[model samples]
Target: MPAVSSPQPSATSQPHHRFIKISRYIYVFREFSKFSIWTPHVSFLQSLRRLAPIPSPSFFQTLDIVAENPDKFRIVGLAAGSNVTLLAEQVKTFKPQLVAVRDESLVNELKEALADMERKPEIIPGEQGVIEVARHPDAVSIVTGIVGCAGLKPTVAAIEEGKDIALANKETLIAGGPFVLPLAHKHKVKILPADSEHSAIFQCIQGLSEGALRRIILTASGGAFRDWPVDKLKEVKVADALKHPNWNMGKKITVDSATLFNKGLEVIEAHYLFGAEYDDIEIVIHPQSIIHSMVETQDSSVLAQLGWPDMRLPILYTMSWPERIYCSELTWPRLDLCKLGSLTFKAPDNVKYPSMSLAYAAGRAGGTMTGVLSAANEKAVELFINEKISYLDIFKVVELTCEKHQEELVATPSLEEIIHYDLWARDYASGLERTSGLSAVPA
Candidate 1:
């Protein structure tokens, strides 16, 4: 699992933090609950008793049965960078049949990454290269990681296949929730959260009447240039943005940490995930990144999800829903010693980081704006990673792309149309007025 680490360290390391204790207990429960499967609530409660190494054999075995049962689970993984290995390992361990669609070269590379899984657990496809599932109808699910439209098709396929989703991609939901969510509801399927921030929001909203949710607060680490002068941002090098102070992430997301686009998409995500109006969600730059997200109740008290900014911790929780269970994320004390400092919260500086407002506007505009912005940001991040653009140009390209598409209709397009919009934004941003103008990739 990709670690969902926060971007900024605690300013004052404490010997102990409450989040550490809670996550450990939660981890154990998620692991054990997988076998106690028939009754998720029982599985959830049963896991609470085991505190040591999680129950790998029984838990994964239960999952294996589901993988072997085609009617139970149909699995798919969207394109991503380093995390593809984790996805492969997950498919191998869980023994789920996997589907991946990308450039042929990438799929071949992915096969190579998981070649070791084949040798070990050895899920050999028949001579025809097809792994058939078992009978008894598996209570299966699909996984998606849509950074934007990149993973949209795979996500739609999995959802359409009647697989409840483990959604890591916020863009799919944010851009197409109006259509996608209704479809899930119609099929009586659930969209489980895999992003820590959104998962935290999902966790907090449970057992409460929907009407009681007043608002949600999404936290951000404010990236590499949180306080760097706006005037100086255009010159920020790849290393500078990639140098996230708190989180260890893929290089592209680390750059996004600097731009606040991750949090922006989260805002849109929260809107769809909870059915909150665009204005109902708030953004706070918590340099500490300890509080993944918070929910405000009708009574005005704010309940927050605080953890050690770890992604797998939440991903495991969703695997066994409606109950708090344990998984691999719970092993650490988070800090072996006094480490995390006092958590701090601040309002974002919109002038310095205009992308913040742009995301909000895209969400509010409520059409293909979110899609365009997301696709544009993907390209900008790509350009930045390839040294074709600077850190500042990312927001510029996204903002421009969004501005170009703000007036687009709000209706959900056929999968083909979403792909079309995605491609157009990437092309449009490539022509953005960067002084570097293809001369400088942000090295």
Candidate 2:
């Protein structure tokens, strides 16, 4: 094609091209040989990851992937769920062996106990991996001094053995932060979050320079009572408090939601999880619950994670962070649906819900304020369910509990002292009966 006449083909030039082809083939053979040596070792581990767990159609169930590779890891489930059935299907697709199917039968237990609210009994709905309690070589014991059940000892043992934890139980950290965080550091295992708010903050802050993050703003739905008049709150029943208008959740969380106490717990979590100080975090009530949480940079710009009021999205997010998976079964949000209404936000009313302030107080005080707040709320909610106090009185008991423990907070006591304070708060709050619907047992 060149205008010049082509030179006669030469055997000497031909040998150069022939040599190049041979070189490429040799390189390919070397790679194939190395792969042969490694593939069996990798596949053997993959089989172990698939060990007793049946897939839940509702969750993304992407654990087997993390199982296959050392780098792929994520949280399973916590909070309540919206698309549990779909997540189960996704898990089957990924074909993970271990799944967290937290007693589907307890759905009736939750619904029966939470008859006043629209709490549907179902799986927490995210990771469908079976957490073999003691099967792994490195089993960690997870415990928190408060809450309905004990979780820390098992979590500690598991972490001690070398298994990284998928942490959902906040009270464990509340009571055992000094022990747990240090031990996790010593062992160098993972402590993944199961709380939506903390998970959101964790995702947003990833890879950001320290100086870039000005602060974190944790959002709350403000519960069903956000619109209820403060004057009339005393007459509110446990049934009324259980009704969260947007998200379907459990009785424990629903009660915490009503008081915005769960949000308070998240504030404490963000402090410990991210190492931010007392003033660095703030809370704003976003009623729709679409905007799960946000973080602000020093430049004044804010980053937020948005989705439907579905816990599975965040659960899957924790499991599938850094790389988003394609789930054909999951629904995508329409711009038309999202843009139809203004997303509203307001500062949490300090007068109506003082729990947020106490949370900040507990977090600032460190030691065991988080443990105390969790235990007190549990005790107060129990009293509400027993008809000893009206719904509004839940906050009253919690407030007095905090006030009574003011000295403990100020002193910044030891972890042992904090656990003692947590137990004392629970027992003291439970002792008094509902004197008036307007208020409750003072610590």
Candidate 3:
């Protein structure tokens, strides 16, 4: 994943200052917003204003809104990649009493950086660190920003601690929804959506009964290959596949976007997040990317969430749910629609995006099969990025792995069984060589 830069202190400010370091707030706001591409400077500035303030003796401490609010988070657990680093910087602004990273190396880095502070938060290390962060005395919510299925275990652990989850990792629910959802219910913990699409659907359905909804309309940018013909996918190069039209994201997801596998995974996520069936969840090609998602009511009315494709809006909401905090972003261009002239939608071409169909099949198969499907796709994408496989071969690897593991599929897999199947799929995909029995060509 592409990591955002850590918020630095200004030249004149103390190194331990919690305020986002910038010589010029407007300049930093524009540059940071433009560079992220997903969130604009205008909205970002407003969002920063909305954060709960923290009081400090330093000149910039007055700008630290995170500490003054009692409802503000005081302990955060982060993992996965670069996004974790960026979020860690923001979390520090709140002066969290405890934070967790995935490894000792990160612990060392945090220790060195936070050493100058008057009160350094406790930093925990390793995968166990995630659970520890959640179980901290003051911990109220766990922001799971990790990528892939690695997020599954810690998330379950956090829920077991009775901590609410602000979930950014889609694979957690995609592969382990059957197990995780039940655990959440038993623990009485809320699973909030951190992804923009699911957040939109969650917001739209807030006051309505589940039965009142007819279907979910998930909008897709059609990815880097959206404009390419089905036959041309065989010739796709890694460079070509990473050219996402709207969002700048990690390589795996960007490639998944190209194959429509991301949307497929989202379909499975939507199923678990909203209790929707496979048939009722739909994908549409909305190239403009203005509307994040839509929900159709039984009465034939569609409620759509429209905004500029700024991820911060959703992330902010996930952090402060059931309450809309004040932010300076009321004027960001993403909130403006007049400049964005037209909006259009078309049916997704499953022929061009085979991963789309494969996802639905995996979702319907229901059991450890989804884990198998996710594991296979993750390995294939890694192989493609490393130049060991063709873009088209990504789908082929997933298909073969799913087929080879058909007998291994369990209708209701225990958490241990799910992990076992996930590992098996990884080994199965990684073991596929050019000389292996499976064809190297895309199916």
Candidate 4:
């Protein structure tokens, strides 16, 4: 880890006198002294209403930012789940030309949201709906948000359509990198990374000439169990495992953080995203998550991207690549150096978090092996979440499944071949849960 440079300004130069108030997506600057500020009673209640944390607003924030410059960027298509009624209503606000949803039951609800529109958008439903949205003639880019190997097929479809990809789903690259990468190259479309860490690496090396880059340093939050001793990990409960220290994410991902498999998956993703060798891409546990990721040049200078851990910026960067758009709605404060206290980095303990090593092993092995690794981890995470398996069993399942797939490892696997290995590994991992012994859990 390189020495972290402090970003603090001198007391005279810094604006510390004004008190900071942050709501879900807005920052309110006011005088620190209550007597100096004027507030109306009705406005005070409205401010209180805005204080509740917004429900996962990364995608919506991107939309809102794009909405500001409707001419420069258009929200022509969408694919989303949950709050379909609300999402559709919002879509009506943007009034995209097309909309897609996985839940067929919500189609009517979506229609109701757009009932008032004079020119209702085309509604596409189910799996084909996802592909249609990706391949829509009006669509210029695809945002892959679906989880696991499920995202790979649609991502491929979007790539074939020559749609630039804003890759939020890590599994697309993890399970199907060999096929996806080639497809992207053949189509000559950009597969922009939307993950914060990967986006940070992308931002760090954006203009720098290739080959001058020596290594990619991915920072990890070290997850829920980072502080636990080696022996304590086996006893970790599912609820306990879901408690990630830094990021607010889905259960599967949260558990992945606990096992360090999230970082492991990122290791493979970074390998494909940046074309860095598995040996060259390294994971360092940075608990702060302030510095998203770093790049080491051939001359050994390290360039890093630092910000508050907000997904909106990264997602926005992908959508507005080559142009940094001003996103006023995402009004979070910038990283203040003096308040940071410290940014720490340490090499991961491979013995405790064997998933990290398994990722490297899978990357080194290549082909369907990485697919198998991801599938196995997904299955293991599901079982662990269901409480059918213990926390440490996550690593056990991934390791066993990957070892079993060594015989099935194929170089340059086709899409179907990758899916085959993915399913095989998932089943293998699930089967291991029944017969796996307590002794199999790593120390």
Candidate 5:
């Protein structure tokens, strides 16, 4: 039997900080290629800082990490819209070369916000600007932090430009895996996982030889409703779902956790990232979230990456791959297993969370089905958040939308088809609220 290779030390003599930028999408971009774009929004920034030892530091704490080390990193490009003041601060502090907003109307708003700044970045409006940032000539890595299918095109543009992707957006793999994976292979672009679970698995498998991996065990915190009975789910409210027990994240992701759709999406992402068959991947409820994820080898040896629920480690590894960064123990607390009495695990209840089955089936269906499943879920969550659909209707909308898309499922989708179906699924899922008789549950 071949021996498992241990991780090697960094080849560089000196530790150099690479220019890392934030993007609003589910990803972050950094230097390596010609141009790279980053746009970390308020929720993303908050999510990154939530698990830190500090108590509610300023909202720009995430970007401050990059700003502190000016020599190691540069802010090249950014995309934002929701919080103009926050965006203005980022622009003022980092002085990125290019900026992109949600739309043309917000362009002036951002400009006016940056009026006091001595150097202003050229602001481009809408999706085109985002694509430009993704494919920026100077960027070596692009972080796909944008939510949903909105991230697919920009990520593709970045990959086409030969930028390594620090993928925070699960939808990129869940939806665009069929198309994007091939594109990455063709361009020699590396698709690195930034999510804790996927990054844990990625770290565990780093030195393992090909075909040695047997099974993947994805750990879940079980979200806010983990302890609630199946019958109690229908009574769940947006605020109730938003109350995550472990991680403080954006509304959409927090809701995804409560539904276990986040885990479901991660399952699909694992399949694409590690080429594991859906049957080979398993989900276990680990309430503590201490062990991010684990992988089993052919000999049944389990390798797991353990860390505090903080997202910084995983995101940091994405940038410093092939080289581990030395983080001060003060800011980055070391995990103390002795202090935590015990770690617990259990099999997830399928009856309570239908997202697992839906995601697996869509993954098995291949082609555009996974994308449809993700888009539908995103739309369904939106409806539930708006009180336009009952909590239970979230599952119904996704299942029904996937069912309706069976006929049009493309086995090997083009980029255009992927985008088309993404938009189509969101539209179809939204229509189900009216046609499928889904009513909002009273708060």
Candidate 6:
């Protein structure tokens, strides 16, 4: 069984300044439009013309929540990639003191975009710039939304600075848990889950007695191919995998959902977040994602967190933790069980999702194997999306990559070693497309 420990205490004192630092890799406007209620009103955007520095619309809900109580919360730093035009527009609205683009090349473009502003923010570029934003002194909490192992270093940096982590990036724990958890413990930093499932578990276990938790039930909205026969998987197209039934997410995550890799990764995350063993955490196919997650106590009593399948509630909770911020019922609609009629659950099919066993095995192996699994899956998904490989090859790529890493696996790896293996796994997984003889899907 994997290691399990109770939640650690957060830092003793909260910071006097209420500043937020956001770090994200990409921003998609289409995903933002899905949360209709959280959308910033046109008048609100117009009102911010006099001020500056907002995030991309993808993070508009986060910004909107912060903007609600301007005197209580402030946007102090931002880190983003590729979407410089959108990033620049946000910077002009929110007025963060510092901004960091993905690389040096994007710095000039971001600067040029902000040249017309009356108040110019200090801009930095590349990985180091993201680190600076993570450890910004004014920020009490840093939101880690950057995808993949790229988010690891900055998240570690934030913990070192004693900043509470609003954890949206799965890799921060899925890949770096062994390294990051100890570091977080050392600094007394609070790691708040910014996703629905983990947030659901975190909420239910809030006041539970130590040693009371017996099991963790993570709900899954059985992805695009949930109802499709197992034999039909080989015919899965790139577009097919991208069409997630419930959540509007990034390309990588949407595909992850279809493969059920997202839930597998979350199983490992639940182990780290709530200190439950691999055997204690289970996934159930819940077609309707109303019940985010549940925890079975020692008395066999189950506690659950329920809400409509919207990301706003979870994200808002991460921002306004220990205190629930009131939302207008008109905008933030209440969950009406009568309208929903019913919620259902069934066991996940192991044959349909080999990723589950791979995740559990890697998680049990501990250290570098989990990171390898994640990196390989990421690369495999990218290959699949590009039609370079068939859908089934995603599992083959990840499993073979993990197998190749077994000999070199380090149970107690340093930050450098974690990063090294992440890169190695991606490279190895990429090479599998050629050597593994997996047929590529016709473009």
Most accurate candidate by lDDT: 5
Top TM-score prediction, candidate number = 5
How many clashing pairs in candidate 1? 24
| Ranking, lDDT, top scorer first | 5, 6, 4, 3, 1, 2
- For candidate 6, write residues 23-108 as lDDT tens digits: 12111111010010111111011121111222222466666655665654456676776678777887887787878776679788
Kindly list the per-residue Cα lDDT of model 4 for residues 269-335, writing each as its tens digit. 8878777766567788899989999987867679999988777667666555565655454475667
Over all chains combined, what TM-score does candidate 4 have?
0.81
User: Which residue runs of candidate 4 sit more than 4 Å off their true CA positions?
Assistant: 1-60, 64-72, 81-83, 105-117, 436-443
Q: For each candidate in turn, give its C-alpha RMSD to the true structure in angstroms.
A: 10.1, 19.6, 13.7, 12.6, 9.5, 9.5
Q: Where does candidate 4 clash, by residue pair?
A: none
Stretch of 10 with least lDDT, candidate 6: 29-38
Which is the winner by TM-score between candidate 1 and candidate 6? 6
Q: What ranges in model 2 sit over 4 Å off?
A: 1-135, 138-149, 329-340, 406-420, 434-443
User: What would the per-residue lDDT of candidate 2 be over residues 118-228, giving only the tens digit for each residue?
Assistant: 332223312121223222222222211113324444455555665444445567576567566777777765565545676677677666764566667888899988998
355, model 1: CA deviation in Å? 1.0
> Taking the candidates one at a time, how many backbone clashes does each contain?
24, 43, 12, 0, 33, 11
* Model 5 TM-score, 2 decimals: 0.87
Tens digits of per-residue lDDT, candidate 1, 215-267, equal 67888889888879888877877778889988777776787788888888887
Runs with alpha carbons beyond 4 Å of true place in candidate 3: 1-94, 105-115, 436-443
Better of 2 and 4 by lDDT: 4
lDDT of 4 at 326: 52
The lDDT values for all models are 0.57, 0.53, 0.64, 0.68, 0.74, 0.74
Local accuracy of candidate 3 as per-residue lDDT tens digits, 160-279: 776566566676787787788788778777676767788788778766753677667888999998888888877777889889999877688889889888898898888777777676
Name the 10 consecutive residues with the lowest summed lDDT in model 1: 38-47
- Deviation (Å) of 340 in candidate 6: 0.8
**Cα-based TM-score, every candidate:** 0.72, 0.67, 0.79, 0.81, 0.87, 0.86
